[model samples]
Target: MVSKELVLKAEIRKENGKKHSARLRLQGKIPAVVYGHKQEPQSIVLDLHDFTEGLHHGHKLFDIEIGSNKEKLLVKEVQYDHLGKKIIHADLIRVDLSEKVEVSVPLVFKGTPAGASEGGILEEHLDSIEIECAVTEIPESIDVSVKGLKIDESLHVRDIALPAGVKLVTDPELLVIACSKPIEVAPVEEAAGAEEPTSPEVITERKPKEGEEEESEKKE
Candidate 1:
């Protein structure tokens, strides 16, 4: 279970667009929007350092303390700057803990494969899985164990263990991991089904006759 501590306050901003966004960043505030269900989109601002720290802790759910009111919202989408170093904008979706929400969870592979020790390659087929579950039940990541997996062995989507109340929405037969042995290639042979070389006498008999060629040329 992963949890994060975030403090978000309700701060209204009338400014919009590139210039305004840049100015907000200069003031150490990140522009964000919150919307979901039957509610209208609410524009809000978050503390830059606090918002970033929450993300670093991998907490998508925030206990937003908006001004004098408190609201629990799930982090929906976070947009990064061009350099991919800073958070530019964020989207938060209000949710009910009792209702199931669909979200994609990252995949994590645990342990080393026995086949890898024997020079076999380990291939991962899936990087993430979608699941429908309560917002509070959302897992940070799903774990798949590859310990002692032999060559030619595979672990499918169904092999992963999910937390209680978390249901996998992906196909059960989807390949998640596979171990393959190193391939060996054989050399090509060009003499297959070829007849043995002819003897010198046979070669001489097959050759064009020198005297016949000269007589034919003279007649022409």
Candidate 2:
């Protein structure tokens, strides 16, 4: 769940440009923008280390301290560098604690499926699911148990049991995972037997030449 105590301090981003952003990164800070709630987007800068640490700790909702005022916001999106290893920019959306919002949370599969004991292969199709819930009630991750899944059985988005205030936002018909029966291979002897029998070679007696046919008729 989003922690109300996780507050981030931000400052108005004055300089705006590629060079300015590069300079900010050099100082261990990144550019960010806050919008939503029908308000004008506000430019800001945040501490790279602190923001990354908060994200690593699963702090999605934050009370951003912008000078004398603080606003509750959700981490709507994050922009990463080309290498996808570093955070380049962030987009925060203002939200009310009591209002409902849609967010994607990680899916955690727990327990070994019963199908595994039956020589079934378990396959996962989704890594996360989208859900709707109050800002403060947003879950960090959703746990799905495959313990009861049997061979050839599957789990879909509709089978998920969400939290009290949470509601599904993804398609219910989407397959989340499945337990598949293993493929069976035929024995070498059986495979060979299944092949079609080759036809017997056809041989024709040599045709008699004109003189040989005449001699045969005379002999008859």
Candidate with best TM-score:
2
lDDT of 1: 0.83
lDDT of 1 by residue, 86-173 (tens): 9989989988878888877888899989888788889888999888888777777777889969999999988889888888899999
lDDT tens digits, residues 183-213, model 2?
9997666444477779999998999999999
Model 1 residue 82 lDDT? Answer: 90
TM-scores, one per candidate: 0.74, 0.78
Q: What's the residue-level lDDT of 182 in candidate 1?
A: 89
Q: Which residue pairs clash in candidate 1? A: none
For candidate 1, the 10 contiguous residues with the lowest summed lDDT are: 1-10
TM-score of the candidate numbered 2? 0.78
lDDT of candidates 1 onward, in order: 0.83, 0.90
Error of 1 at 156 (Å): 2.2
Q: What residue runs in model 2 are displaced by over 4 Å at the alpha carbon?
A: 1-5, 182-220
